[model samples]
Target: MPKPNEPILVALVLAAGSSRRFGSDKRLFAYNGTPLLQRSLVIPIQLGLATTVVLKPTDELFLPSLLGCYLHHPLLKVVYADDALLGMGHSLSAGIRSILQSSKSVEGALVFLADMPSLEVKTVRDIIRRFDSNKIVVPTYMATNGSLKAGHPVLFSRPWLKQLQKLSGDNGAKELLKKNPENIINVALDDKGIFLDIDHPAEVPGAKT
Candidate 1:
């Protein structure tokens, strides 16, 4: 693990996905007065992450209106991905590319999504402490009385950048995690925050802080 004082150059937030299935923009969905995306970012921002958010404006130039959605977070850098309709993988690449363009010294990239507001900060810190610049630490959540569930907020080491760039379409790291589950250390976390994501309109209300 890098020393606590060592600076981490970037954290990529993939938020450009079109919410066609959900019938509305999920990221903009509000919960407890905060946008879903805003709640999802609380953990990474505290880790000193220079977060790069990938967003695509609608064809009618909706960026101006949506800019209001991201207002007040001066640290948030919004990069418009004109081709966001392509897929989540493209958005992932776009966020990473924006970070690289800004600073090449980024030791690693912690990829989190715009819907997972439940991810615990301490769990995130635990993952960072284990990021030795070679391995990926992904969280696994076990329900107190139910089955286990796994999800994103995965930490990818620096060496995987080229392969990450090759990602296309919506298959964002799921397949890779399967191939090297051994290389991918699973940090056990009981927090449902590890498993909760606002996939539907109603699910939005139940999402954790």
Candidate 2:
């Protein structure tokens, strides 16, 4: 867990990847009139002052378009990842490093994806409700009768920052998630937003509609 003013928990939105599947700027795609990327950025910023974004080195053209039009918020700040093509692990590492590099005073980082606009701020607020000195919390939603679907807006406590920053390849926090099940406290939820991510152009319409 992190101290409130200590800037312990920062929102790391990985927005550097090219949306090859969508064939368009998935980050800028509008949902209910607001760009999905902008909403992603806003969710964390509105919750904490330490919210930061990770952006891949990209053409000045499209990057600026979204930043100005949608992601432009006073609390939102940008950190650059040099190689966006190295997959999600690189972007995740870059985002955590950016904060660790700028200030060691940070407690932990909370991670979210760019295309998941279905998640609510209350869901995130609930996830952060149990901030502590050394525990990781993850949200699990009820899937069906007695079944649970696991996902994130993951809360990484301070002790795991080193493990998270050392991540590579296509692997995400799953490795850690499996290794430390006891440390994980399930933040129960039932919303589909916990699993909704725009992977294709068709998903965009379904999520928004």
TM-scores of the candidates in the order shown: 0.84, 0.88
Residue 194, candidate 1: Cα error in Å is 1.8
Please provide, for model 1 over 1-209, each residue's C-alpha lDDT reduced to its tens digit, 9 standing for 90 to 100: 24567746467877788788778777767777667777666776777677777777652355434435445465578877767788888887777777777777778888888888767788877777777677777877777666657766788887776677667788887777778777787777767776677778877655333
Alpha-carbon local distance difference test for all models = 0.72, 0.76
Clashing pairs in 2: 1-132
Worst 10 residues of 1 by lDDT: 59-68
**TM-score of candidate 2 versus the correct structure, residues matched by position:** 0.88
lDDT tens digits, residues 1-209, model 2?
A: 34546436777888887889888778778787777777787777777546667786664456666765434666677877776677777778778877787777677678888888889888888887866658887888987687878776888876888778777666667888889989988888867788788878687664442
The lDDT leader among the candidates is 2
The TM-score between candidate 1 and the true structure equals: 0.84
> Stretches of candidate 1 above 4 Å error?
1-9, 59-74, 143-148, 206-209
Candidate 2, 119: how far from true, in Å? 0.7
